[model samples]
Target: MKVYNTNQIKNFTLLGNTGSGKTTLAEAMLFEGKVIERRGEVENKNTVSDYSDIERENGSSVYATVLYAEINDKKLNFIDPSGSDDFINGVAAALSVTDIGVLVINAQNGIEVGTEIHSRYLEKAKKGAVIVVNQLDHEKASFDKVIEDATERLGKNVTIIQYPLNEGTSFDSFIDVLLMKKYCYAGGKLEISEVPADQKDRAEELRAELIEKAAENDEGLMEIFFDKGSLTEDEMRRGITVGLIQRGIIPVVCVSAKKNYGVGRMMEFFTRVFPSPNDVPPPVDTVSGNPVKCDAASPASAFIFKSAIEQHLGEVNYFKVMSGEITEGMDVVNNKTGNKDRISQLFAVAGKNRTKVPKLTAGDIGQTVKLKSARTGQTLAAPGNNVVFAKIDFPEPKFRTAIKAVNESDEEKLNEALQRLYMEDPTICVEYSKELKQTIISGQGEYHLNIVKWHLDNIFKIAAEYITPKIPYRETITRIAQADYRHKKQSGGAGQFGEVHMVIEPYAEGMPDPAMYKINGKEFKISVRDKEEYDMPWGGKLVYYNSIVGGSIDARFMPAILKGIMEKMEEGPLTGSYARDIRVTVYDGKMHPVDSNEISFRLAGRNAFREAFKNAGPKIMEPIYNVEVWVPADRMGDVMSDLQTRRAVVQGMSSEKGFEKITARVPLAEMNRYSTALSSITGGRAMYSMKFAEYAQVPGDIQTKLIEVFAAEEKDE
Candidate 1:
């Protein structure tokens, strides 16, 4: 393998819609560069980019594939990530380390929802981009219409550098406006020919437009274009390269990746026009809070963007050399985990295939095996540098499911497998909900969760079941109520006897103000009344006041009584949900000195609190979430109507770009599988994101049904 410097390295990520042929384009590039002997198809499950079992089975790319090729002594590293929204984190991770983004658009479909989503990401990252109109050989392909659509959506910075001369069935040749020549494919070989007379006028017009756009990058070039009427080939190339690096021009190229039509020409353009690593600005160091340049002589620092767990290989961490050089046996420290790790081996990766390399220079992408502590989005730098890179920002998981081991004994194994899987894909989150008493797994969507389940079953051999997670509803009182309870037991050893009388009421925002109060007909000066308000860790308030007077109950036994009340609160009297925002005042109680142990008072308090709760105006509160749905303008009415059916409160509605943005607050119970529902309603053209807002009272009918369901389940148990 040949080592390349930062200037010779061209790092770019292929991004597009799910069926835009991104993997096919990668395969074509590899074959053209002679990195592979032949191109592989996604349907055949042989493409280098979609090699994972899940991807092959799903007939789509699920993970990002690292591939590299050398052309004209320059190394071009391509990060081909899954185009589906379910796996969009891979694209984000790849973009964090790449210099350019090549958006592959299906000519037949033109611009779709995925294209808009990816374009927004590219804009947010502020990275240069090239639009590749792929699938030109498709029967319904239209180069002109697609170009118009691309320009409208991606802004006027888009310029056409190449176009198919005869699209659709007869798409075998294309005219390169920059080179003023034609490239025709014949017998598996490319032949250079003169531009056809019929297309010459259009090609020249496009060329003049390209020249004008390129000249805008430099003042001198603009003056020369005005005076000389045209720029020399060398001058034009330099200006275009400058425009591309600054994103002043986003050149469009045409290719039929499956047939290898015009792919080689695309590769040539990447090597000549795309910006190198050195051309891109440096990223900020999270620890030092300074920009770190891509300098090999500086302190060595690298960032792990992706990680994969192979059966035999254990863990393979894919990283980009951010600064300095990474070599074998180099001792480094993980900034995020604060664990020291030694790079035992460095290999340049092409899909799952890797070749051992002595060292990887700055801006180069490579992988190493068996790191003890490093994980994705972690920075590994030299010991003295103490510089940590910013972590890659992945979208929050939007869908959740409760996972249970098929066999009770496999619970430990199931947990371990989930941990390992989460390490491999940070977007997949695993959480243990103590309130719900279930292991919850969250991911981008249904497809994402399905992949996780598949891995748990097949890779770890741990059978598991996924079900809709239980909502963490809360119980709270709305009115004041009083009750008394006496617990007495005669066990022959020492009889237990205790009595408790308590007043319960709904806890308001500012209750229990410091003041004097009377309890048990005694004038007790309650100076620290405000201190009785205890903020519950799980949210809301739990106010407890000791109002017993005349030593009716010992001070030491008050904690026990509070503990008993807390236990009752944990498992509420109605529906067994956790209770919140309630005040319990133990005004009076009786105790037998011999039988008045902590246990006796505890049972007395517990029973008293349960009695008061049943008398109080108890209500069930379900978790509500703020949901924002983005859909096509024409489907706004349909989405709004659907939301109303789910008892959602529409907060606002607005238009953004070409989509309608709808904001609403909906109960979590009503949002189960809502992502799937939205996709179905909009024909997979809508997207939504949600976050917890606040707990709201469930509807009367719904609350009744929930209580009935819980009681039935308890009876069954």
Candidate 2:
């Protein structure tokens, strides 16, 4: 493969809904570029983009397929990512390295969940888009309705560059407004000629609108357009180029990827109308907050946007040269891990096919193998440059489940394999919850994690099953109570003796310290000799007041007493959950100097704290999460009713980009398997995100049930 400069390269991502034929479109593009002898179909399971085993089994893309095509003396790098929301990480990875998103919309269904989702992502990234209305040859294809839907959903930026002449099963032609020409296909061979008289007026009107929209992006073009009341071919291309780069124009084109109709013309538009690598804004350095220009003379720097383990290639790392150049056998330091690695091999990748390249300049995407400790979202730069590109902001996981090995002995293996998977896909999150005592795996949706499990079961040969994840609840007290306990153990040689008197009360912020306590009409005046406060790891504070006057109990055993209290705090007395927000006051205590020890004090402190906690009106608290759910307006009421059943507190409701968004606060326990349920209820047209809000007391009925369940588990143990 020849090394292409930044200006000669154009990178784009094939993004759309699952059934929108992105893979088929990629295959058609590759075939048109002569990279392949023939086109491959997605239904035949031989498309260039969906080459992986899992993708073939699913008849869709699972991972982002990084491929390239040389067309019209220019290199076009294409990243075809999965369209299912479950595999959205692929979309994120592709978007991070591409300048334009070629959204392939199904002609039959104009605006879909995936279309809306990917459009929002493109808008968020502030990148340009080329709307490709595919499947023009399908029986149900409707070009006019698609234009209307695109205008309503994607705004007026969606201007038509091409309109199908006959969009049905016999669809074989389209009129290109930019060139003011007609493209017809007979036996899959394209014929370009003048627009017919019947379609001339409509084509002229669209061309005028296109020229005006394009000219609006550049002052010189606007002057020429205003003076001439039209634009020349060269002037239109120049104006459209600027419009695309500035995202002022989102030109829509039509293609029957299956029949290869208008595919080459679409490819021509890509090279001539789309923004080149140098035209788009270069990535910024996260460390210096400066733009990394696409200059080959600068210090070498590359950012690894993705990494995966190939069948026979070990681990392959895919990166974009953010600045300068990346060459084979170049030595660079990973700014993230501070580990130097040698790029022994570099190749231009087209799915599974690789062409060895001597070097790739800035803004070019390539893959390499055999790097030491290089991972996704890391930067490899020259020693002096030390540039790190800003990482891709991946969406948070919406589904979670506890995964365990079906065979108990495979637990370690399962964790190791999961970590490897996480390295390939950052959206596949794995963490062990110490409080819940389970290893939880989370992802974009239930199907996402199921794919991970599929990889484990098939690739790693590790047997695993997902179980219900346990919620990390908390326990706290509501009232003040005091208790006294004594620990005395007598033996032939020595004895252990310690007595403690403690007052327990709920702790709240901005409250005064210990002063006086009136318990059961008995007033106990207290003097705080020494005070120790702790910020508990679980959420709240644990304050310890040592009121031992005159050193009644020597301060040496204070730590031991605190340790015992902390143990009970970690494993609450009622339900074995972590305790929080309570203050312990040791107003009085007695100890035998000869028999006193840390163990004795620890036992006395533990028992006294437990007794007082039981009498202090303890309650269990569940974690609440701030949830934002986006669903179609028709499904909003059903979603709200379901959330109410989960004990959700509706915060607000608003409309967002053709979807109704509902914000609610709900307990974590009620949120298990919510992603799956939402999909079922909304017919997979809904999307949502959740974040931790705060912990609140559980309802009285739920609290009783939790305590009973905990006691049953304890008895069984």
Top model number, lDDT: 2
Worst-scoring 10-residue span by lDDT in model 1: 522-531
lDDT per residue as tens, model 2, 1-717 = 789988889999998998898999899899998889889888899998899999999898999999999999989999999889888888888888889999999999887889888988888888898899999999999999988988888888889999999999999999999888999997877799999999999999999899899899999999998899988988888888888788898899999988888888999889887787778887788888998888888999998988999998899999999888999999899999899889999999999988999999988999999998998889999887778887888998878899999999999999999999999999999999898899988898888998998899899999999999998989999999999989999977789998888999999997888888999999877898788889999889999998877676888888888998999999998799999999999988898969999999999999999999999999999999999999999999999999999999999999987799999999989999998999999998888889888999999999999999999999999
lDDT of 2 at 700: 98
lDDT of 1 by residue, 318-366 (tens): 9999999999999999988889999999998889767899999999999
Residue 426 accuracy (lDDT) in model 1: 92
- Tell me the TM-score of each prediction against the true structure: 0.92, 0.97
Candidate 2 Cα outliers beyond 4 Å, as residue runs: none
**Worst-scoring 10-residue span by lDDT in model 2:** 274-283
- Which pairs of residues have clashing backbones in candidate 1? none
lDDT of each: 0.88, 0.90
Would you give me the overall lDDT of model 1? Answer: 0.88
